[model samples]
Target chain A: MTNQEDQFYITKILEGDSSYYTHLVNRYKNLVYSIVLRMLKNEDDAHEVAQDVFVKVYTSLASFKGDAKFSTWIYKIAYHKCLDALKKKKRNFDTVSIDATYEIGIDQVENGLGQLETAERKEIINKAILSLKEDYAAILTLYYFEELSLKEITKVVGGTLDNVKIKLYRGRKMLFGILKKQLDPETLAIYERGTK
Target chain B: MKEEQNKEMEALSKKLFKEVELQSPDSNFEFKVMEQISSLPIPGSMAKYKAPFSKWVIPITIITLIGSILLILLFGTGNQYDIMSKLPSFNFEAISSPLQRIPKTVIFAMLALAVLLFAQIPILKVTFKNRWH
Candidate 1:
């Protein structure tokens, strides 16, 4: 929905017709759920945290001054809620170093990706994203999947634009590195020969 | 050369991400959220206002502590005369003589009750904040 449309429902809800909130919730559920799931990496936890995000959004709707898009605002809430859940669970993911990411050539990753079926490619990408550190995974998701610009992402992730840019740059490389690792040499060789 | 490769990588990643479907919550996700929202107090409704207990705690504590210390000084020891002599303008005996008639056991019990009540404020504040949030 457009920001104007969002503001319309927000106005109605603020005027005490709270049923209009269902519209807002329906609009952003998938977007919010996707981000939460990507960060927490657990379906059950994602479900719970996503719901909490909406309930929080509903309760705090009065404070939303329309300074940012509703999507960005909800994303900020989802991001922090996921962090809280991760902190509570004390779960950590192995972060691939930037040097390691750089060592893997992009041409090799692209060549390997060209060999996989679309479904396989999708699975590999999703799994690779889920394996990265939370901040990198979240930044990549926000930038690539949600199509939020670096500035909007900064607002959601709460850092300088340069910091987000660095994360995005490194995150994309890390994702390519992970994807290359997931594609076995045999599969790439077979597909490469088939293409030739 | 590096910039061209980075551009290619960006394009490839974007194309791949477009295929990554959003993970949906359960079918009842919206219903569950709405149910929770319905139970919430409507904005601007006459929801019972709960002032944080901690805000009142400081002043109440200061008053309680001062009152207790004065009571102890006036009755807990033989130093009532010393305190009274210092505040000669005030008639301390009139206040202390009547309070002294109360049994020492009752006085101590009241003081203990006040202490317990103040201690419970923090625990109760935390409980209420947790429940509300």
Candidate 2:
């Protein structure tokens, strides 16, 4: 969405018309919810966290300076909230090691996944993301899911662009190792086709 | 050996990263967020205009400060002569002497103290007066 349109909705919401938030919620709900679900690895926790994320965004909307995109700002909030929920649940993230059983399930999951096959890949991808160190996972989520440029990701994550690049490099390496365990040769071929 | 091996690994890594995409939530998700938000206390509910307690606190503090100063001035010092007169060697002349009646040192100290104390009253009153009707 354009900056001008965001400012318009902001003004309306600030003027005691909170229903204006529904438009923003509709626009980014999927993006926000996906990030939360991926990080928490539970639908119930993800749903609760997603609702809290939007409420926080609504309350803090007046402070939204246009320094970054609206999506970037909202994802920053969603990302933090999701991580907080994950910590509350006491999930582990010390070091990531992949299990080969994930490899066996790939063939079975591939046929049943249908159009959601990509989504199933996302679920596995989320496990990989959650296994990463907190700071590295944050950088990867902001970069890949939010589709933010390094400069924009720097502003959102409050890190130097060089740090963002280094973390992305490390995150991709770690993710590759994790995904290789879950992805069969067919999916790996499909992934290759996209890059080609 | 190292150069060819590194290039192949890079190709494989990028291939894996591209295979994943985001999964959308179940269809009922939006309705659930809406329901949750609706049940929350309305945003800005705490922002209603009212005279803050801090506003009243400022005046009350000023008044208490000034009142304590005035009470100290009124009651802090009393007649030393009256107490001293009860002593056997205390002469009526010593007690009733012109010097005793009004000491320049005492008068100067009282006047100076009163001037300083009274000086603060106007500034305090002016600040407190503005706070209320």
Candidate 3:
């Protein structure tokens, strides 16, 4: 729904027609769930945290001053709630060394991805995304999937614009690195066939 | 060449992410959230403004105790001690005379301490209430 429509429902709910909240919840559930799922990486934890995000949004709805888009506001809430859940579980996302030797050209990787069925290609990319550090995975999802601007993402993720840019840069590199490893043999086979 | 590759990767990422479907929560997710929201106090329905026990009770008790002490010191006649003398109790003169000789500064300090102690009750009550919420 449009932001105007969101404000309408928000007004209704604030006026005690709280059942209007169901519309807001339905509107943003998938978006909020997707971000929470990407960050938490556990269905059960994601489900619980997503519910907490909506409930918090409902309780704090009056404080939403319309200074930012409703989607960005909810995303900020979801992101922080995921961080809290991670801290509670003592789950850390420390940086790890990725194998750097598996680099392949983007064109070759693209050709390999094209050759796979849609579901298979999607699975490979999703798995690679899930394998990265949580911050990188979340940044990638927000940047690419949600199409939030770097400025908007900085607001949601709470970092300087340069910091977000760095994360986005590193996140994209790590994603490509992982994708290259998974698409290596397939791209090599395609290369061989092309050479023949 | 590096910049060109970066552009290609960006385009590729955009294309791939578009195909990534969002995962949905359980069908009852909205119902569950609404259930919890229903349990919450409605906005602007201010709870009844019942005064906290410490807010009124502590001050009243402190005032009564101080008032009773003042009344005995200011209004008690010499005959008030006649009842004690009849009981053949330990000499009240020793205690009463010594109490009167005690320094005014000391009396003021003790009264100040009592006031401070009573003051903290409401402060602590407020602090704990804030922490709980």
Candidate 4:
């Protein structure tokens, strides 16, 4: 929904028609979930953190001044909630290798994207996205997956646009290396069919 | 040739991540999100009406009280004639007889209650101020 549309629901909520908030929650659910999942790997944890993200959005709705798109604002909150949860658990994002858990599936990835289900293809892409460091992964998801501009990303990641641009550049390079390393030659060829 | 190869590499990498998978939560996700939102106290509710309540109010009142007491104590010890000399005083002839008829018991009770209140109020004020901190 547009900012004006979100504002209509927020006004209704502040005026006591709090049930109108359900639309806002449903609207951003997937976006928030995707970002949270990238930040924290576990599905169960992502689900729980997504709930906190919405509740935070609902409670803090009054402070949203339409300065940024509703998507960026909510994403910012979700990003922060994930960071805070990480800190509380003393899980250092800097040191934890996100790609360490996965067995690199060279055989399957080499099979080529010949007739893979649309959903399965995305699932493979997600595995490749996970190979970067956490910050890089998040930025990659926001820029490529979420289609957020560097300005909007700066809002979510709390850094200057230059920093986000740098991350996006480096993150793209890292994803290239990781995917190249994990995918067999034939599959990589199919995935890169249109380019050059 | 070098620039061309670099461009080709960048293009190839771009194609791989171009169609990113947007991962979503389970189907009942909205309902679950609503459940949590329902449990939370509404925004601004927690901070309701909690003004700083003027920290100086108690101190200023206390200082004014002590100043008043000091002024009263200083003048109360003077001889009646010396006090009367400062202002021309005429006794209220009409209320003089009624004052004598007041019961000593009632007067002593009022005096005791006043003393207790005056003694306890400063202590109560201090305790109340500390609770805010």
- Superior by lDDT: candidate 3 or candidate 4: 3
lDDT of 3 at A144: 82
Q: After superposition, how far is residue A110 of candidate 1 from its true place, in Å?
A: 2.6
**Which docking band does candidate 2 fall into?**
incorrect
Worst 10-residue stretch by lDDT in candidate 2 chain B?
B45-54
**Residue B103 in model 3: lDDT:** 52
Q: What is the TM-score of each candidate against the true structure?
A: 0.72, 0.57, 0.71, 0.62
TM-score of chain B of 2: 0.26
Which window of ten consecutive residues has the lowest lDDT sum in model 3 chain A?
Answer: A93-102
Give the DockQ (2 decimals) of all models: 0.33, 0.15, 0.30, 0.24
lDDT for A174 (candidate 2) = 60
lDDT of 2 at B92: 62
- Estimate how well candidate 3 is docked, as a DockQ score: 0.30
TM for candidate 3 is 0.71
Task: Give the whole-model CA lDDT for all candidates, comma-separated.
Answer: 0.79, 0.62, 0.77, 0.66
Ranking by DockQ: 1, 3, 4, 2
Model 3, A147: alpha-carbon shift in Å?
1.5
- List, residue by residue over B26-92, the lDDT tens digit for candidate 1: 9999999988887665553322233434456566667766877777666556522344555678888
Q: What C-alpha RMSD does candidate 3 show over the true interface residues after superposing them?
A: 3.2
